[model samples]
Target: MTSHSAPKLAWTYENRLLLILFMTFGFVFFDRLALSFLFPLMSAELHLTNAQLGMVSSALSLTWALSGAATGAWSDARGTRKPLLIAAVLGFSICSALSGLVAGFVSLIAFRALMGIAEGPVLPLSQSLMVESSTPSRRGMNMGLLQGSAAGLLGAMIGPPVVIGMATAYGWREAFYVSCIPGLLIAFCIWRWVREVPPGGVRHAQAEGAATQAAGGTTVSRWALLKERNILLCVLISCCFLTWFVVIISFAPVFLVENRHLSPSGMGVVMTCLGAAWVLWGFAVPAISDRIGRKPTMIAFALIAAVCPIVLIHGDSVWALGTLVFVTYTGLGCFTLFMATIPAETVRPRAIAGALGLIMGAGELMGGFVAPTVAGFAADKYGLQFAMWMSAVGAILACVLSFALVETAPAVLRRRALACAAARLDTQNVGGR
Candidate 1:
């Protein structure tokens, strides 16, 4: 894999970078979810209240949004990513480890916020890199694996068990201490293996930039990005989808145990279904989009997403509910399209990272910061089902909004172009005959 001729090097480089980025994002999520996974132990030990927990989560999200946007813009302007990415991995890992040392609520908030600051740029930076390196045909799938599958498997599915098991055996603090190890290893891998951008990617990006410039897009400031319809729709979609995601993740377990009167074991099983669905559709939806086009895939998956919250409310029998949830929980795949793939395809090559960061920041601010508070308030005032219904509303809005999106899938667009060319040629031949 390492030694190859130029033609083969592109392939090798693409795979190597994909594998590393996959692991990189996986560790990012692993570290990111550590707080929630260890919250019970930390809450008990620090005597923290529900209000403190919300504040703590919001603190991280606030910094995450700001840092993602700022860091992305910085990298795009400077024309660099590797060093920043390496620093981000190291920074977040250390911060996650520091979580074990927190004495009280304030310290926890400080470390989590620091962690978010470091972790924020990882998505846009990694995605921009992925977009550059990948072949046009595989872009959707590569980004899907990097963003969806990796996070779903490492963070959502396997993370809780490992964290809880370690906390149970040693202590939650000890679990945090050990969490830094994976990030350190992943950072080392990136430092050694990754390139700033591949030769093909650089050329491809140049070609893309030429096309954009010819289309009268000379520069891609954040404000300029907003002027593009696809970027605007993607940002709004991010907000709504984040609401769908955050509310479900935040309240699902408690809602099951308390509101639905499901036993603890039953609730755990239902949540497990969510983790499974997150992993399965994470890559599947985007890969399918590669063939069918991003618009149809997005609309169809979002329609599926709307049904998941309702299924949670009314679904009966552990086996039946898990199946229903898994089937309907198709939003993770759509996330890759809207959050990374759509933006990358729509914007000029230079501003890929900034566009991603802006959408992410806006989404996190609404879904991560504001939505939770509002959902929690509704839950307290009414009931947890109110939060579930709110999630459904978010998904439905995202579906409706997706109708306005222009087709961005390379394969689909290429097909249309070829068909148009054929039609033009046929008309010319008939006139000549």
Candidate 2:
């Protein structure tokens, strides 16, 4: 089996899929982060504590991790992308609308968990779809676009101000109700535009055959995938990355309001910097990896991220803190790299989605689920500043783990292959002479 590259097609199904999935994920982020922005209002009304708030946030992540682990494998076995995505979008949209009707802590947690179950599969499955649709050269950038740039910008940057304004005018509950409308529309669009591609389909059969030969003509077992060093490391590094991520998004607003003496509107303005930074780095860094290599790019980002908490803790002024937040989140753009691009490039195509699920699931379970709960507890017992250090430590550990990663960028792999072939050909010619 010979490996062949897909031609880069502009303004076709590929671009269209990217655009829709990009918007789909943007709505997903909007719905999820809306809860964070509204937490202060909800807490005041419901008499919730810091620990209870953390538990509410963790509830979604708990179900998300559990569902993602199963759904990734299920999608792989089912060999369809569109139906899963459609179901996920509709399920979460309805749940998001229903979130407004919750009466107390139990109901709020339960609804969020249900939303988690619906939304969990969207990340890995959409990533798998994007990879299949794109040319090899564009895989990293497309994944970034879907997971980071557009989604991050819409969800984090625009979502904060928009949701905050809506809450102020209507109510926090109504904001949740309003957020679901876009998701419902995106679900309909996906059902219409998105096509399913099976594993041995006409377009990808050659790529699959080549991958099989590369694996010594054997099918990959789930157990075998778990054993790969890169796969294991990706899961670990993602946990660290998510630790930094979940803590900030879940509690940063609270910290700003309570400890830093910033108003709700001011906090919204500062948090928008995070989204802006994410948009910039998310689009630029992964595309840069297409040329430089994944390992080096990740290492650089992780190192910068490790310092974010320290800078953020010391900055007293709003503009200074906002600038630091931007820098910190700029490093966070590598979320796509750890979660999808690296795992996909390392594994066979058939195993890509499942591998992504493992990476996402494990990270969410530890970093997303547990980290925030612990941070909230720490903030309650120790102080908010102490809680921020937890994220800094996680970022440092992520930087350490990144050093162990294997480079799997397509361009780098191809360059090495070409060099090897050239070396062998030169030896053969010299012997003949």
Candidate 3:
């Protein structure tokens, strides 16, 4: 009998997990953005003031920030991501569906806040899982797809067009109703397939929890994370970047529709352009960072990001506007770099979830909660265009702050270390001779 070696399957656990998380995080954004897309249509009928709309926008952000911080630490300590992951996906989807039933501002924000509670930990937890599964070389790309492109593609690219079409035909409420279905299905998939991974990748879930417990990932305090310079810089960047992103997405659709005098369809077209840009630049930036270094990638992309809102405000034709939107919307790619990549590289594996949660929470608190409310008041008092300017300022601030971020990409650091080692070897050999 001849013994034959079996060919290996190319589709590994890493690929499978990435695909699942890509969908899971993507749907989270899709449901979150549904309200923003439907706002222009519902604002008048629901009698929402600009400030109220801003608050409504911030509502989910507030709760999400708090929930994410708590749950991220909880997951790290417990070393159980699947149950919390399943619960968040299921809870948020149901809450998003309930938004369709709200007739007034109070109920709308209430539902949004509840949705935030459920959606808060999805990103950090998903990232923790991905980091565990990903090869060192592919960490930036994998996490970028998970954090940036997934949201951009589903929430921004596909979401605006679909929501607008539904709102146009069936009315805005129906769009919300339909958005809930995807998250529910994603939750079931996660429950069935997703499992915990040990810090060093040697142990399975059964052993991981105990190993993780001994390593002290569970007992680390949130305040202690602030001791690291990279974490501090990331948190600050999150504040400014979130201000730019949240304020624009929250107000730009309305700005395009009312301030630019765009028809709903025209607004949808422009929004879709932004989404497409988001999808392209989102993953590309982080992948580039993997090679070039995270700091330069952020500085360059944020410079372009600062220009996006300006072009939207100034460009007259849809062709001109759409082209600029795609070109300047490069900041989404930087999100994963600072939010998850930088933190993951800086902190110990056990505390990664906590670090991710803190960065997100701080950003949400300021950028998500505070910025939108202020911009809304500015919109009402000055004009909607003011909101766009605010977005630009946020990007500019992030660009300046990027100067301070320590280089953390593994490939970059590895190459530098190799060069130093080679130089040391040459000097030692020469001295001996």
Candidate 4:
């Protein structure tokens, strides 16, 4: 009997890469957000205050911002992704496991900050890789999928229950320990499956060629690249969006339980709606934007998100609150659009990671680090419900900023350019006739 080799499946390298990165990003969110679910328990055990909790969370963001900027530049210069990604996963996983061993606020902050240093590069770097891998037409959709997995599936939906349940049954410490396992597993998968693209390589060459053609062979320096109007707008928009995100994630659970009188389990249920909305809109909005335009989709969603906190303050029932949460997240799909896709499309391919890093760092500094601290202080002094207005204000600002964005959708730009060319041809032909 002749032995035949089995037929290769349809799963391409891109498919495997996406699957691994998806899981990796999911674990990143899962690990980071596990703290949110455990906040009540941790605050109780450690005798911490709201301000202290915000400070601890802010520590992570501060370091993450600094490190992300540095590492993103480093990644761009180095032009290799696999080794850095593997190292990041390992570092974060170890720190996550150690978080379970912390005894006080100081130790907790230290550990989380360390984890942040490791994690800072993951998002921008992974995004850079994914952008290089995807065709231009599908770029928004691909990025949305990655962000959705992190924010919706793993972070919001599954993370709360699993982490909270573990904290309830075993201990919050055990939950931390368990969360690290996935990171380690994913690190191995990345090492085995992912390939690196170096600087001045095929993707970089293509991007340079495109840039040369577009600019009539004039090359822009990296410094000049940073001065572009779109880059500045992207940074501001990111800050606004992140302010909304950090406030909601940091204090919403407490507000639900204490202000609205929902139980922990009930808060989890409401939070699940956040995940579902993120998944639904994260995929749908970006996909739609591919057809329509990023600016309109962003403006519409941001307006919808801006109203959620106002309605939520008045919402008395779980259904009402959940629906509002869903609406809020639908707007947040623009987060992926603004931070990853827009900045990527705006810059030369070689500068993608660095530009993303700058955008992420700026957002994290203002939104992630400062916003939560201010909100926590407000919650302590005024009320948790009042603190939610901060997010509402940020959302409104983001909606306004959406209008300033240059339409960067490749398909849309191509269609418009073609239409203009066709119209010019028609005019010339009529004049000849």
Candidate 5:
């Protein structure tokens, strides 16, 4: 009998886990961003105002912010991530499908609010799981790719045209319905493949295991988590990132078509390049940063992101525009990598999910609420070009603020210790004990 070597699996169980993570994120990107591509079609059919449209978008963000804390806390207490992930997916998918059915602004906004409520918990829970699942040796690479796939790469780029085509063929509602199919599939996959690990370390799959005790219920309060200055600083830094992120993603296509005189196809291509650049950074940079340390890379990215907008606003050529897009996406991608590291550095084992909920919810609210509407008003009063340029200025502010954040790398432990000390002193004095 001839013995044959066992067929080597192309992807180990671990690699398959990464693929599942990527797919989950891909659905999120598609669901969230497809709205922007469908916006024009919806506007034309419903004859909506910019404010009304912005309101609809804002509704989702607002609910996300509102519900995030509760959702995160609940997930942490339950010690299971699958429930939250599955619920978020189903809620968003159902609401997204319902969004297609709405005939008026009021109905659409209500459904969006429902979607936001569901959408809120996903990031913190998913990410906490991803990081825990990863070997510390490769955490940054895993994180960077996760952010890149979901935020920068396929979600924003490929989604636009797909949504656009569906809208063109069937109507805006049909487009949303089509988008819903993929998310449902993804939710099922996550249910089957993804397992929730405890935040502090590895945990048990059954009731009476060592891992279970290792991940036992956290005693930390939400108030205590917020009191950590490093965490707060991270949140403050994220505000800037969120502002720029929302402004660009929400308004870029509109600006390209209205201000730059690009055809829909042309605008789509520009956005595609921009999205692709982000993906490249997500895939390439964070992994490298894991080796070099998160702080130096974050600071460098912030500084560069600050400059990218200025270049993007003034450039006229297609090549120049493409170059600017790449630069901007790179900076944005770096900011994302920075954001992912905060919980790893700040939150204790038990409270990671809650911390993430607070951070993401707050950032999403500010970004969705203040940035885009202000940009829209600016576009109405001044021009789309000016609005975009102004948003870039906001990005620069975010960069400047990011300088204050303690680096997430292990080398920055001294700084973190110092910050914690200063924070403790401030609190002690403030308490008047």
Candidate 6:
């Protein structure tokens, strides 16, 4: 029998960019999850409490929120994807490696915080990098494949088995060290391959302004972007999305292992199934929704997510929960679509990266920072069920918000482009002698 390859250009610039994004995101998840795996080891060694553990989890988000927007702005002003990509990868990996060496909780938090700072810019910058490279028509498909397939599904699947095996054999610290190595290699790949998008070109407002002024038309300030309505909605959506995402991802595995009494290998298998389903849906659903409309897609997914809690809480066996998780993630895949497509539609071309950074950073703060600690605390006190239940509230809110979201398609962009052109021509005629 002969072997056949998958589509070749599914392995094109779009695919490569998606792969890089996935690797960066996967490393971050692996790094963050290390703390959870290490907690048993670190806590016994240092005599840490639940409260202390919460703080350590919180530390990642605290640093991320503090630096996220600034990093986005820097990317916007500089338009240098490779530098941002390289710095985030190196910083996070180094800090994550150093975390294994920490002797106390305070030092651990500090190192994890540093890791947060390093990793904070990667998500927004990755989105920005993709938006710049792809057209609006394909943006949903591209982002869905990159984030949903590479980062979301692939990372979740790969991280567990690797983390579990390494932690079991060599101890958790060794796992952290092991996980950091892949990122270092990825940093090299990003530096070598990810092209630098030069600053001040066709995408910049100032560049457009200069061209418009030379043609006797008024120039728009980048600052004017702050006044847009959809921008505000994007921020709100990000906050809700992050809150829900964190509520689930941070604690679900812990629930499956501790409360459900599954072995680590069993837990890994279930998660791998769930993760594969999610990545597959992430690739598939967004492509379908792109043809239908983002609004309808979001609403449908949000509603599906709303049902996931019921199945998880009521399920009688591990197979039930595992099956439900897979179904739930199909809906969860909508998140990547929303995150990617909304900004490309809502924000001005020049300000997209910076705007996306602000939204993503804020979302991460809510989702990654606050949600995890709260979920951890709740899981400790009221049981994991409460934490899982709270996710229902978030899914409902996301569904409601989806109903209110703007529909951005090619037609919308064409109309807006035509209007801008007409307004420019009108202004130019008035200024002509």
Per-prediction TM-score: 0.91, 0.91, 0.94, 0.92, 0.85, 0.83
Across 1-433, the per-residue lDDT of candidate 3 in tens digits comes to: 1122111211266788888999999999999888888998999899988888899879889999999999999887777788999999999999989999998999999999999999999998999999888878888999999988899899999999999999899999888898889998999899887767522345333355566567754466777899899999999999999999999999988888888888888888888888898888878999999999999999999999999999989999877888889899998998999899999999877788989999999999999999999999989999999999999999999999999999998888899999999999999999999
Q: Model 5 — TM-score against the truth?
A: 0.85
Lowest lDDT 10-residue stretch of candidate 3:
1-10
lDDT of 1 at 378: 73
Against the unseen true structure, what C-alpha lDDT does each candidate score? 0.86, 0.84, 0.89, 0.81, 0.69, 0.70
**Which should have the higher lDDT, number 4 or number 6?**
4
Q: Worst 10-residue stretch by lDDT in candidate 2?
A: 1-10
Ranked by lDDT, the better of candidates 5 and 6 is 6
lDDT of 6 by residue, 1-433 (tens): 1123222332365557767776777677667666764565466788876556766777787788667777877766655567877988998889988987888878988998998899888877887777766655777887777667765454676666777778888987777776678889989989877755422214454464466668986422335544665566666666777766666665566666667777767777776766677677777777877777778788888777766656666766777777877787665467665666676777666566677667777777776678777877877788888767877777777788778777786655567689999999999999995
Model 3 bad stretches (over 4 Å) = 1-11, 198-200, 203-218, 429-433
Error of 1 at 121 (Å): 0.2
Candidate 1 Cα outliers beyond 4 Å, as residue runs: 1-4, 49-51, 199-219, 261-268, 425-433
Model 5 gets an lDDT of: 0.69
Instruction: List the candidate 4 regions with Cα displacement exceeding 4 Å.
Output: 1-11, 198-223
Better of 1 and 3 by TM-score: 3
Question: Cα lDDT of model 6 overall?
Answer: 0.70
Question: 1 or 3, which is superior by lDDT?
Answer: 3
Question: Residue pairs in steric clash, candidate 2?
Answer: none
TM-score of 2: 0.91
* TM-score, cand. 6: 0.83
User: Which residue pairs show backbone clashes in model 6?
Assistant: none
lDDT (Cα, 0-100) at 181 in candidate 2: 89
Name the best candidate (by lDDT). Answer: 3
